[model samples]
Target: MQKSPLTSTGEALLRGQLQTLKTSERQRLRHVLEEARAHGDLKENAEYHAAKEEQGLLEAKISYIESQLQSCTVIDTSKLNTDKAVFGAIVTLENIETEDKSTYQFVGEAETDMEQNKISYRSPVAQACIGQEVGDTVSVDTPSGQIEYEIMDIRYS
Candidate 1:
């Protein structure tokens, strides 16, 4: 399978989640299963059935997380080039039409969080900004229409 990219921070977050799932989550689910088993006969036990379904789903999620962690490659941000809009570079963009400006950090797919102003390198904005320098203008096609942005700055930190 092709390896997916992950920022160091994203890798750490996933690892933490996996650890929690394997330890505390598993222990808690085991207790829940035991409680449901004590309720009575397994033939018509709704609580037991529901708990089993939930436990299966939880185990599936844990397995998925484990696979994802194995298939991801963590990237080190500090060693990357900051001269242009690339992975790990924080780019400030100005809307050519409205003059509205926003800054976004280009990160791996797993690290994309809108609330944190961190976008994936594969995203349209990052795709447009890639290999671009300050003062350069890039146009991106959106559902509404095409939008233009001027590269204002690029920083590593």
Candidate 2:
């Protein structure tokens, strides 16, 4: 199986999620199931059916997270070189056409949060920026059109 890259923070987040699912969520669901079972007939009890469905979904999520954790390779950003744009690097860019500036942190797919300016390394923008140094310009094709950005700074934290 191909190993998926994950940031140390991302790995911790996944582990926390797994722990929550196994402990608090599982306990809550068991209580819900027990309450549903007390409502009598299993065939016609909507509450019981709903609880069972929720339990199944939770279990599936737990299993999926476990699988992801097992196959993940955690990358320590602090130990990496920041001379060029790379995974876990915080890169600042300036739009060549509009002169607008933006900052983004390249992370694993599982840790991507656009609202937080965290992008997946596999994303088009990150792909274009990877291996590029400061002052380098990269053009990426977007849904609207091709946009060019010049790298201003690269930092690893």
Candidate 3:
């Protein structure tokens, strides 16, 4: 499996999620399944069916997360040079068309959250920003259209 680059924070978050799933979630789901099974017949019991479905989903998620963890490579941003944009770099950019400035922290796919301004390195914006330094202009093809941005700052954290 190809390893994916993950920031320290991203790796920590993934580890936290894995721990929660292994301990709290797994135990809770098992208890729920037990209760559901005790209720009635498996074929027609709504609660039993729901719990079984939930178990399947939870197991799938656990497997996927485990696979990602197995292929993850935690990247320490502190030791990396800040001269250019790279994985784990927090980049500030100005949209050339709107003159609106925004900041984004490039992170692993598992940790990408748009609300937090964290984008996956494989995302269009992050791809454009990669290897770019301050004052460099890059164009990203978005669903809305092609947009251009000027790199304003790059920080490790």
Best by lDDT: 2
Candidate 2: give the clashing pairs: none
Tens digit of per-residue lDDT, candidate 2, span 24-114: 9999999999999999989999999999999999999999999998998999998996699999999999999999999999998888899
Model 3 clashing-pair count: 0
Count of backbone collisions within predicted model 1: 0
* Per-model lDDT: 0.88, 0.94, 0.90
Worst 10 residues of 1 by lDDT: 77-86
* Collision pairs in model 1: none
Q: Output the better candidate (1/2) by lDDT.
A: 2
Question: What RMSD does each model have against the real structure?
Answer: 1.7, 1.1, 1.5
- What local lDDT score does residue 49 receive in model 3, on the 0 to 100 scale? 84
Regions more than 4 Å wrong, model 1 = none
> Can you tell me which runs of candidate 3 are displaced by over 4 Å?
none
Candidate no. 2 TM-score? 0.95
Which runs of model 2 end up more than 4 angstroms from their true locations?
none
Tell me the TM-score of each prediction against the true structure. 0.89, 0.95, 0.91
What lDDT, from 0 to 1, does candidate 1 have? 0.88
